[model samples]
Target: MFGSLGAVTLLVSAVLGQGFATPKANGTSGYELKQGPLDTPWTEKVGTTPWPEYPRPQMARSEWRNLNGVWQYRNASGGESEMERPPFRQELESSVLVPFCLESALSGVMGNYTIHSWYRTTFNVPDSWTERVLLNFAAVDYQATVFVNEKQVANHTGGYWAFNIDITDQLNKNGTNELVVFVFDPTNLWPYNVPIGKQKLIPEHIFYTPCSGIWQTVWLESAPADSIEKLHINAGADGKVDITVHTTSNTTTTADFILYEPNSELVKLKIKVPVNKAHSFVVDSPQLWSPDSPTLYNITVKLGSDAVQSYTGFRTISKGVVNGVQRPLLNGEFVFMFGTLDQGYWPDGLHSPPSFDAMVSDLKVLKEVGYNMVRKHIKVEPALFYQAADQLGLMLIQDMPALSTSSVFINDETAKQCPGVSLTPSLDPDTVQKEFDRQLAVMVNQLKSYPSIVTWVIYNEGWGQPWEGNDGVRNTSIDGILTDYVRKIDPTRLIDSVTGWHDHGAGDFYDNHHYSSPQCGTPWYSTPSSPYNSETDHRIAIQGEFGGIGQNVSEEHAWKVAASINAINNTYELDATPKIWNLRAHMILQELEFQIQEYACSGAVWTQTTDVEGEVNGMLTYDRRVNRMDKDMWRRDIQGLYEAAARRARTNGTMGVEGRGGGGG
Candidate 1:
């Protein structure tokens, strides 16, 4: 039969071809042989799985398996094909490094694969693991069907969430065990069968690249037959941090919970509770969490032989009247949140970071730039990325990766180039609602526990939905559904209902995006203006996106183009770059200061932290090796600006009103 040893024989035969190469003893060697600057020497360092420091830092596990190494892979030709068929192959022609996506350069197989592909790998069970084995995939793009020893086990449909399967019964204790995963992603065309965001088969402007297959860590863990299946921690301003522990067993178990301040001793508490029941704890004088000062409490839960470590923050986020004006309050205090529009992309790894160190480096850079928060622009990152922010105490404004029609305000060329070719349009009301609910739910479920995420941007600049009509009529209701969905899922966080254009008059704050200027508007406009240019009254305002100034540093650029300079006309190219570095820096600093000092803009997200593809409007180059602007000066000015604005808002006792003194729209 094709499903038997014949598949192995066929695979062995196929490996004799020119492209087929034996698996290198060291996994990193294969990554260096791949083509493109996107493919660098990623595998040079091996064994240490730098990210092996527990994939889920927020939710810790003392006893778990790390399945983040080489995995057998073979390209599926398509249709009802058995793994043991004549064309079925697996002689190490290619070995996909687990945890990284196949499309990413780090995977060594930096080549594109059609929607459906079959991957197979085998390993022996460790004798020490006598309990139930749970197979976990951090994330697999689109849809995946998993099988163990040729028997189907589980299936997952989302690309940005985690899923697990219990395979204790299917394991072969004495012999090699086989694991096969089949993935199908039809994201190349429009109106995909599944909800997808900003992924295109062709990498081009704005919609940079597509990430398929396993993009996150894959691992296995053995748990006591009656172990903690899941947990939830809720931190409130009332000094009560609620916890709900879900376990598989129905027996009553003694639970002990511990809380730790940053770099401090652990505060432990023990309580007897029924298994699977919710438990609550009260911490008096809890440390409040906010953008200005993000404080997190480490939590450790023990049940019988099972122990898990996690963290939360005691905070309350709400809209309240401060000095007679409604403003965003954190722990009962009004604070301005400033951040960057961080699209977590890498030159080498694309959607995946080369290592956990690489991921932490990005967050550290943002902190260094004096940004209190970061708007995770459109893409949902791995859990550890948020963990880094939570541990490092950085605020987060997360956006659900958008999946709808391209914005109308985008340049006509960009509009034509990146339209809803394979996306469910906003006009399909049912699809829109379904996708909106599905994605919003997934986003919230994946990120809600992290205290760093204080705000949710439901929509960004109307990229996926048209908030304005052709006749210039604004549709605030359309934007309301998104904001409402976010609030329904996670009422604790603030919402930037419509980030760029179309003031829906909804959401907790007045959010706006400006690229060319840092001009602030009045609280209310006597005459209605364009959505992008209009000024609003009655709410705290924020400059959501601005300062897309670009400065090219020689060594940091990844492209092969030679540096050019046209000093006379001030046009800078690859080689002869312009001396306008200082000019660009000054403009950004002055505009930022103006928005902060003059306008009292609550917070601002500079265009970005790094250049994405062709949009070279980042403070740093795409490779992250260079900073085009003056780091120290920008940091000092931003710190001073935010401090001054915060002090003024505190003194005024009101959310800064439009036309009061703020500048830039």
Candidate 2:
């Protein structure tokens, strides 16, 4: 059977292809690889079986193989011989681990600015899996081309989106089959407007290192000829959930669903539904989801012999007026949102997290320090990240990773130092808008099922896709068009078209970014005026980003934190001691109280979650060992401010004016 491999299975690819070549000896030709400062318990166990856990936890299957270790790699230029192609014409130069980017030390190839590379691996297919076998790659940066058994199978573009290929016909059932992948990532290079968020050709203060090649999990899954390809579960505050199942077979398919409350360990109910159609069910006295109590329903969908597991939560996200000011309503009640700017970068993995536990630890720390929300700034994390947030009761604001070859820099002195020049968009490549729209659709369709995601951020500081007019006037024409499209696809969540600057008077929030010296100040809009034109009326005012206080930790614990940028300049002064940091936290908590009590702001996000590269303004060090701020002060002072704000919003004369549990309709 396919699930049980025979002992005849060869562990290496040398026996499969006659032309397959061996890896060059270590340190003979490849780049000098290195490791990060901190390592989880799982790091030492990452030998022939790195990241053995299932990549897609939401929609999961039992019979799958993780292909994430010891892939032969080669670096070649355009002028190299044709033998450098796939199916092993010669021995590769080195070996690297899969799912880890090339720029990362964990990948075993710590090279930089590499434009082209190739990977080779081998797998065997059992006789029972003759129906169909699917090859899945979670993400590959820039461009990728694949070949199986010396035949080209698929080619894909775009960095963040996932793609799959059906390779049943190309497999060798009796012997080890050869798999080859060629990747080319021109990060921030000319002529390509790919989405690379905060990745620059030259590393600096804010923008850090770039990643390339397969930065996510690679796996093989076996399924019946007719199976469920995609499943969507949308939960509402009215205790109703709409389930849609997309199947490969066109004939009428029936699927059985079993619902269970994971926390209560109680079996709720069971039902059968038709495939490829909307099926709705209403529960009695449903346990709603919120920051205080997050309730998830475990569901299993079975079609024929193929089965997959998933989950969803009951909640609603909308916007309305509270105390004569517009704000977000969760489950139809005004709730204050306190968030942090999460860049999702790891000291070792770069774009990917070191492990699932590592990712959860960051969220746990944020929750411990009294943050209820996180703005996932300019990056689309894996599905499991959002699923964790749904189960943990943390809200998320997702930002689209901007695309272009230009830069968008804004600081405390941006408005004062550069008056007219601070509001311009980067140089636009003609083909980028189309690619961005396609990626946007993919992102929404893949992630809209999560109840924790309350808002979608279209742009950030105008890094790449910004709108500029012929007469040099800033407008919201393009932003309005994009927002309309997003609403059509997903009207359930609110949209923030442009987060920091270039407010085209569009989207749901009057988003602003301020990093002045005092670290705690609120803006009051008496006339409701827009930054570009006349009075604004549609969106609620919010402070998207602020408070970037730099503090360098001891070199013994944080040596690699400043290695990438300050390689030569080692003059970083550690002026922020424990007392200074405590005072800083107190000032920020006082500011948070002021913003909530006096200012009419609904939400505020701190600068970042962890330090990255040379930017040492994060609450935690890059290795996640040290907490830069005072934890006791945060829980005692900052957490109370958020709770007080929510109380004020609830009792400010808007209760029972509208239905408190209505879904977005």
* Top lDDT hit: 2
Over 4 Å off, model 1: 1-33, 38-50, 79-92, 193-195, 249-254, 261-265, 272-279, 290-294, 323-325, 404-429, 466-478, 519-538, 553-556, 560-579, 597-600, 650-665
The 0-to-1 C-alpha lDDT of every candidate, in the order given, reads 0.63, 0.70
Q: Please provide, for model 2 over 134-216, each residue's C-alpha lDDT reduced to its tens digit, 9 standing for 90 to 100.
A: 88888898688888888889999878888888898898878888888888876665444578888764565666678888888
Per-candidate alpha-carbon RMSD to the true structure: 9.3, 8.5
Model 2, CA-based lDDT: 0.70
lDDT (Cα, tens digit) per residue for candidate 1, span 548-650: 6555444336533222212212212222233364355455556555545444356677777777665566766777766665666567666666665665555
